[model samples]
Target: MEIKVSLIISVFNGEKYLRECLDSVIRQTLKEIEVICLNDGSTDKSKEILAEYSKDSRFKIINQENIGLGASRNKGMELAKGEYIAFLDADDWLVDNALETAYNEAKNKNTDITMFQMINYKENTGEEKKNDWFNLDKFDKRFKDTVFNYQQTKEFLFHLSVSACQKIYKRSYLERINAKFPEGIYFEDAPFFFNIWLRANRISIIKEYLYYRRSHENSITAKCDEKFFDVIPSGEEFFKIFVETGNYEIYKEELINFAINAYRLTLNSITEDAVEEFYKRSKRQFKKIVNSPYIEDFKKYMSKGNQDTFNNVLNSKDYEEFKKLNVNSKGNF
Candidate 1:
């Protein structure tokens, strides 16, 4: 059978759980699919595990030096022959029917992107946090098993976690929009997926949680290094893209909210001495974004909750209060 989907997993010394990850993909019901595993210069037995999986014709292995996650996934996208492409982290696994369920809906609706839900999988206890954005109560009734065009889905895009794994993109659609992850950046998904989401006319959402995002200490988001600040730049790159292309107001509320969140994360993750400088820099950015030519339009279009946040970001006293609220919510950024 011709390959209908190409699932890419980028690895960097992930031998410990690599077998389970590969097994999940190999056992997928979507038979017409290829598992593309990119070995990012692993110093461990990751290469060996990949070699064992290479025995299966459907497994495509690309062993390269550590070029980071963005570059590795970019290579996989360039080499993918399938009509649709999806991502899976080396440390994470699929839900057996993930590709099948996602592909069927995407192909049937001719969607540019099909997004499913992922539960945080706990490695030690094998328990999953089922309370997620995908939970039925959390989603609008109209969004369930539905297809949304660009304008219809614009607001929903902001709620997306920016994780490439929970989404499947049409190969041609990605090429048309030049949707690419920024190499060497820690938060490449913020800019990359936002760009893609803007260009997507048809995006489908599945209520079913078809992916498992493992929660482990080794994950990048779990770390609080200098790299944690990369999300600020990543968000800015796309914020400019929206403004330069005259698409700012169309997603102004989202862009502004994302900026505020980025500012909060930066403040929480940076050293004490760096906080003031970061705050000043972010304040300037906030001003630039909020001083939009369509600020009125943004206010009109923004949801109530967002409007309050937007107002607070612009106000010194209220913004300080907002910071206090987020004081205890550090470390996860």
Candidate 2:
């Protein structure tokens, strides 16, 4: 059977929600899909749960030592055999028609990429909310139901969500571009996302919310540990893509805005114990930006508020001084 979509689920100690995740795949309305589960050294019943689902001929499980989500995804891409590739976190599940709808849209439109909406599901409260980031209404009405590229939607570039799970890519397109997640990083999606969207020739969107993203304390996103620092290197790699592709100068302003916003969010989220180190590294990154050849452009495009924060970060002698300045400027610590 020709596989229309290869759904890769990266698992690591996700036993609690493993069944639901696997069940959703097996029950997908599209039967011509392959489920490739990368078990990244899960110590819990995750392996056993995968074994149970492996009975389905469409399901395949590959076991390996813990290499993190990014590497596992890359490995899954290598093993995938389908016209299109999709991703699913082991802790998340899909609506019954996700693959069917996304695959049909891509195939019919002959698009290089197809994106859909995601619903955030809170584990503790069982609250479900539509993720506004994926809302396509923000784009111009003319772009709807038609194939387009980043250049056409460049004005709303930063508005696009970076979550890999929210989209599907043509296997040939990904291979042609050598697309792969950045291994050993917490924000791998950022680099992978920027690379694809910036280069894709044809992209489409499905307004339906087909994926459910679970929110829990144990998730990497909820933690504020050493891994949070990974954002620095990730952001560096992200900007490098634009430079290598000669799109840096064209999208410089939007890119800088993205970096500033990302840094600010990270600063606010870092744990107290790690905040100092994060602040130091962030300051170094901002200094590099300030020293770049595009400093004038940065100054021209950056908002007054962001400029003040950037200067404060560079002028402060240390994290303490930065904190004091920040508290005074924002009226809070």
Candidate 3:
């Protein structure tokens, strides 16, 4: 039997880039694939485009209220009938033969998760220009002996930021761990990928750059809002889970570095309403981190940028220091 893959996408106000994204998927060299587009209450032509695409046999559209990316993904999971699952952002796309290459390799190797490289393209770029934006150098020898563990995976993530688009996962593994993207949240890919990496065994890697990620201005990562701070609580939840289950002392440094960097990012993006709440929550969280029994290990990864942010949080009174922090400023670092 031929292997089947489901390409799931969640969209909101994606009319501008919807067609291009869909076109890339339809043109993939991987023939036995299904395209499931979840319309999460887009107030634009996004729904119209989905309707138009529904005419294709492989296209399936689900209209849903604005339940956020997590819920949309979970809904897609429920509707998907494929053995292997792949995620794609509405604004991003895959290169030709991307899925065909990854799928064949993963199946042949009998691996649980398979990953590749991605190229980020700008909006105005033409087809040829878009393909040239990424660094395509392959890294075969370096990662050859790297074994998979929760700690090794965490360290690797420090270098390669967790992106949902760069990998294809098995549906059985996702189901085994009950790994659904959390509903009503931003940066929702965090807990999901963290869980997947730790759970996956027999993983395979491809050095090819197969995914094209578009860094659009209106993308979710571009919105530095109050909801951004929610990442702290969500991250804390992941840390606790990892520690309790793995008993791995190795993630301390990376965890601290991740937390500190995230703190700076959150503080720098705060609005008036987000300032007081962010200060209180983050201050408490940082204190917990610094006072933890493993403080010394955590300090090993204390980046200069994190230390500055922490000091600012400690010395300031009632959002004053936070107000002094740059919000969308140039060369603030």
Predicted structure with the largest lDDT when compared to the true one: 2
Q: How accurate locally, in lDDT, is each candidate?
A: 0.78, 0.88, 0.75
Candidate 3 — worst ten consecutive residues by lDDT sum? 130-139
Q: Candidate 1 on 111-150: residue-level lDDT in tens?
A: 9998888888877788888655544233477777778765
lDDT of 2 at 120: 89
List clashing residue pairs in candidate 1.
Answer: none
lDDT digits (tens) for residues 1-333 of candidate 3: 353898899999999989989999889999899888999999999999999999988999999889888899999988887878899988888888998987887777776788777877766554333232133233346555233434444435545546777888777878888887767767777777776776676676777778888876787676677777788877876676567657346666777777678777776676767767888888787778678876676656677667667656665675765557533233244
TM-score of each: 0.81, 0.95, 0.84
Off by over 4 Å in 1: 134-138, 269-333
Candidate with more favorable, higher TM-score: 1 or 3:
3
Better of 1 and 3 by lDDT: 1
Candidate scoring better on lDDT of 1 and 2: 2
- lDDT string, candidate 2, 1-333, tens digits: 999999999999999999998888878899999999999999998888999988999999898899999999999999999999999999999999999999999999999999888888999999997645866555666767889887887778788889999998999999999998999989999999999998999998888889999999998888887789998889889989999888998998888878776667777778899988988898888888878886898788876567767777898999889878887775232
lDDT for 223 (candidate 3) = 62
Local error of candidate 1 at residue 96 (angstroms): 1.2
